[model samples]
Target chain A: MSEKIVITGGTGFVGTHLILELLEQSDAELFCLVRAKNTSAEQRLHQQLAEVIQGSDYAPELINQVKKRCHAIEADLQGDITSLATFIPSGVSQFWHCAASLNYEERFAAEIYDINVEGTRKALALARALNVDCLNYVSTAYVAGRNTGVILESPMAEVQSSNVYESSKVEAEQLIYAQQDMKYRIFRPSIVIGHSRTYHAINFSGMYGFLRRLIQFKGMMARVQRGYLERESIRMNVDPDVPINLVPVDKVAKQAVAIARSDSSNTIFHLTNRTVPTVGEALEVLFSTVGLPPPKIVQDTTQYAWIDEKFNEK
Target chain B: MPNEIFVIGTGRCGSTLISNILNHHPDVLSLSEFFTFVTDLGTLIPQAFPAIQINGAQFWQIVSGIYAKQNIMLAHDIAMKEVLYPFKTDVRFNASTGVPAILQTTLPHLTPKYDALFDQIHTVITARGMATAEAHYHALFGWLAAHFGKSIWVERSGGSLRVIERLYQHFPNAKFLHIVRDGRDCALSMQRHNGFKMVLLVFQITEILGIDPYESDDRSWQDDLPDELISFLPESFSGKDFLAYDVPPSLYGHYWSGEIMAGLDVLDRIPAAQQLTLQYESIPNRHPQYH
Candidate 1:
């Protein structure tokens, strides 16, 4: 039989795509742990994969292969990990822990710690117990936190997070690194976007949120055109030079699966765009793509004092 | 018939907790925001017409449909009915004139034959496959009653007071518990909560209805009772008849206090045999009087 490989967060954006890519090269039996609430995760995963695969002429046959090999096991990372043990058969070869709460504005800090930090710790414990051949954990490149200017692919001994989410991820990464006996591989991908051609994916993250907001603003403007309200040009401070690294979802999945399959001892691979677009250029492309006039860009970030003031007002 | 208890409070008051607690009661099946009519109309009006703004007649049709199909899944049935007939009447009425006026003119003029035709659509929905409108309502109420197993059914929905009179019209035996907090704190809390901004918009509309906008340290309500709310209240009852229960600004504190007080007030109004009031602080503490 094929090697048994288990992945958590398989229903998520990156995991869903990554699992599909993995099914192609390796004859590994892929299992993903999905949260119980999403009863239709398998269906959703299939639908998303079909959208991506159907468009591609080369990978048309991989659609049925993915459906046949990939299986979703219901278990929440925030809940007891021991419950998941029953799903994994005795001789599991590889385990991938990809689940993490990526929401920036999670109300409680403890919730972030519970899911991101404690959850990783539990996954590591489970991996150790199973005696898995390889444990490939997916983390974010932002685990470097607030440190800007040439973030190396190497792991940092210390991190300083600007937000609770970043801090929790940093903590989780640190916990994973501390597990001395575990044979681990960490894949840190940058802000993932739609597949290369259609710029479409099932999950929404990073630029997707900004795009949604822009679309809403445009809709509001359309309403104003009908004499609802006077059209107002939204202004924002975006540094023209700040490099915004956005890797396409398919590229990230492909690179991650390749790294997982390779015999190289490199424990970490930075799945980031080597040549990233500037913040200004990215915004221009995004607005133009959606048929909206580019926003009036403010040079100084300090000029947008109202943004902070409004948040403080709350 | 099981006693129908409603915990009516502004948004962000501990309605979820109250629902969960009531859910624990063997005789009580407390549901969260079963605003079947509003949610259905909200989705349908936007989807079908797309151009026309939602009005009172569209709302009434949605509500009437829900009342017409109450035996089906309370929420899903209403949603489906609205989707089936997005417009109030077959007249294809002017969108600019608004829904309420359209409904008033259209409903009374419609022959009894048309009403029967509409009712037939609901019956068709009830008889359909798995996840049918009836099944959804059954699952919703059944989950609540079976899980809690209490003799009473309590439903806590945000902005319920906005439609309390209408709700009372349908469930005549229903007792309302309106939980009020300090306006300022409620507004601030609302700024964080999901439906608070919409409620504030409703408050703004109430101001347009010629009521005194009662501004406090927090936010203002028109004359302690907004005109819309005043219209809903019995004509015999004045602004003073509705009681204001003050709550602290802390999370869940305002909600719990308002819920307990609303229940107590309802209990006081009902004949000695019919009502029971339970406090939030007392629930966890296990107060003997409440148990």
Candidate 2:
């Protein structure tokens, strides 16, 4: 008999990849918790899965297999999920909670708390109600906020976080630990991007937000003066030598599922890239791709001119 | 001087709420913003601790002196929301006419008849002979606690953690309740606060000009100050412009972390038994009334 798995955030970037990984790795019947917007939950999950699978160079028959094995139960993790325990089938061995609000701005702080912290509370309650064998949580590696030094793949100490999103994740991780009796496994993935092979991204934020702004600025500047970007340089107040850890979604999903399948008990796995890229290295690729001059990374702003400030604002 | 406890934290970390909670307790006489009002921003440690002995008149002057930041805020009509003194109802002091340092937050937080309380405190504080500043504080807080029929006193001022070392020197026997919140939330709250905005701006002024604007008459760096921060200085600062300017929250975040890091060193000097560290997030579970 195949395993029965229940997962939330099946419509998300990492969730779609996880579904593919689970399907490829084992004969598991997937029950996805999806929030219906205009269409049915099943439709939403299928649509996201189709885009993710098609975007990658995977075989066409994967979608058919997904359609056959994967089932979507209409549920909002932010709302009352206690009733979901009855809807989901029994004998489910794995419960993966991947839904989270990625908004890090201060304005959407309350909503972020609602989705990230309180939503986890509801997810945990539903997981308990369902009596799943293990609760597999997808947390962010940035939970170790502002701590300079080596971070271990274990329980985090008291941390001083900089934003609501990271703080909310820290709180969520604490909530998971507070559930001592329940068996659980935690995955802390760093800055997830598009698949390594296809580079197809559903959510265009974080690193991509910077990319979009650069491209948009280039387009705007070209209309004002031909070959303007090629001539003039922009100043960014970023340390070009600083390392940024960016992991691919497919790799994160693959590692997460592999650990989940193993007999690991109450362990934390950091799904991060071994080789991190410097800000200058990443910017070089971006600049070359957009046909713009490389930005002058200025850590000091005392000598910044008006034009330098304006260009950096973009 | 009965039992003493200073509830300290980086400002906007729910210290105000903690002070209010302590105020409601039958055995605790909560002193709100006492240290903040009495000490100047530039000379917080020296002013607060005061190694030398001072007469009643000098102590009264320290208590009633118009703090430069407070004066600026009042003159600009940008008083912090934490200044709970009912300037509208009280005839003696309004925003234009200066409110005494003690009357600003401490006395008003204690009672509705804060004007009468002020008169009573003035009579007691000024009648005393020369004594150490710490001794004067003891007599004052001890007298206040006795007058209110409380057995213990807890003095909580927003951003008191910055001067925790000086506080330890003055009140060596006092227990310290260090209430901390998430730095991000603290920074967000501090960014919105008029008092902290002025303080951060003053900090920038100090860094750029090599002189504390609140302490020195040297306006040498007025021209040297950055264009973005110059408007926030006390001289040209206005309520409208202050609110309109979106000061980066990260500045406050850095300030919060700096204070916490410095405060931890001071806390380490004190015995572990005298200290009680509480997370602002966890306080609700311990004291539900705080909710």
Candidate 3:
């Protein structure tokens, strides 16, 4: 029998892409836990994978081999984990827990607690229950929360952010570290952007949504340019020299799956760009590409409010 | 008090201009779509009603429980008085706390039946002193009028035309201003506006209502619409129905016209005096007529 690997949140952006990458390396039986409502996960997975493989010039036979190796099981992380006992049957060789609520504006602490912390707890419990050989978890580098500067590869001891999503993830990391018995690897990725080439997939992060909004605003302004359009750029407490580390989704998945298959004992890897683009450079690139004049970057924290406000308005 | 007016419309019409013009009013509190309210409704309401079981109750109970909380009432008052009543402050407070505060304060007083639980939840939320999110104009209008002594409140919410009836149910005294643009221009604007999601949403809604959304102009509506929307359509409608369907005539003109007409019919059920209609083209030329 082929080795079994269970992936929770496989219907999400990262998981969808990760499954495709994993298929290229292993002929393992890949089972993806998807929401019951997502009856089309199989179709979506096939479609997304087909696009990626086609771009790489992989033969149709190879693509078929990848598809035949994958399967999706309807499951909700918010529900009881014991319900999955039947699916995994006694033991699974590996597990990936990538499910999370990434909404920054999530106000309910309970929900953040439920999905991020509680969901992690359930996944951990399931891994133990299944006696999986190894467990790999995907977390965010922003789990560093309000802390600036070098965010090292370790569990965050303290979290400082008004964003419940970040706080909850920090809390979840604490829970993961607290478990001494479970052998696990954690991948902390920064903001995952579109595929390196296409920039495709439903993106709702970092500069994508903001740029989309700005473009839409530009379109609106084009329709009626009568208003006094005041455009100003400012810098802030965030080091403009500090690189904005954005990992492409394809790279994140490829690196993560490759690392999981390796025998390295390193429990955590910060899957981030070695050299990040500074806030100034990011803004310059974004503004020019979006057809907005380069914003005047004032190096003051007070001016940060204006840039922050623009994002909030979107 | 500042005259805050919201011009709600279906996506891609003229809501941006309506909001911009209203912002120009020296005494008006105008805002674009504050999507946080809908997106975070699950979390915000429960914060206001900690004792209430979110999944256990009926939908109305959940809504009533949120409305009955005391902080919600206070937040509503504060938002109207501080943000909406005076036009001087250009800073928009985050809706995160204001929404729950409004629900915390108002829900209890409005419904009194949940007063006990409301008081309990109110104590917890106020103790934290977090800023509540402002309710969308639909929910905030009545509270604004009752507390701030305003007779008319205008709210501009894009894609709100789909729920004009819900707004009416919430504030019977509230009036709607439906602003539409030339369907062709709107559709073309949508294409340029990264409105694939909006186009898909419109298509799906139309398909579900058993309305054929094809036009004679273009055969690429399926490509133009997002996959999310295509998935939402009735299974009976084939991708071909979406593809071969006319674009310029249907999506850009007649189909949108039909949707607008259907929305107007819903508004027509309200007293004729309570609803007003405008075209995007007319907005730049004419001053708004207030009763």
Candidate with the greatest lDDT versus the true structure: 2
Candidate 3 on A1-314: residue-level lDDT in tens?
87788888776778767877777778787877766553476776566567656654345566676578777666677888756867765547888999887665543557768988899999898888878878888888888878977777877776686587788878887777788656788899988887778676654555675675555444433322212123433233445576788878888998999999998663888888766778778877877887666665555546555334433333
RMSD of each: 19.7, 23.1, 19.3
lDDT of 3 by residue, B1-291 (tens): 233344666556776567656555544444334321231211232232233222312322333332211223223332222112111221222232333322332332223343344445444333332222223223333443444345444555445665565556545666567787777766565443322322444434433332333222233223223333453333333444434333332233333544465577678787777767787777555443210
For the record, the alpha-carbon RMSD of candidate 2 to the native fold, in angstroms, is: 23.1
Regions more than 4 Å wrong, model 3: A38-41, A51-62, A89-91, A216-239, A301-314, B1-291
lDDT of model 3, residue A8: 82
Better of 1 and 3 by TM-score: 1
**Candidate 2 docking DockQ:** 0.01
Candidate 2: regions farther than 4 A off? A216-230, A307-314, B1-291
10 residues in a row with least lDDT, candidate 1 chain B:
B68-77
Mind giving the per-residue lDDT tens digits that candidate 2 earns over A253-289?
9999999999998888899999989988988888878
Write the residue-wise lDDT of candidate 1 on B14-40 in tens digits.
445566566666566555545623343
lDDT of 3 at B83: 18
TM-score of chain A of each: 0.86, 0.93, 0.85
Tens digits of per-residue lDDT for model 1, A164-249: 88888878877877877657788889998877776667644678856654554444323212211123333566576788999988
What DockQ, between 0 and 1, does each candidate earn?
0.02, 0.01, 0.02
Give the per-residue Cα lDDT of candidate 1 at B287. Answer: 32
Ranking by lDDT: 2, 3, 1
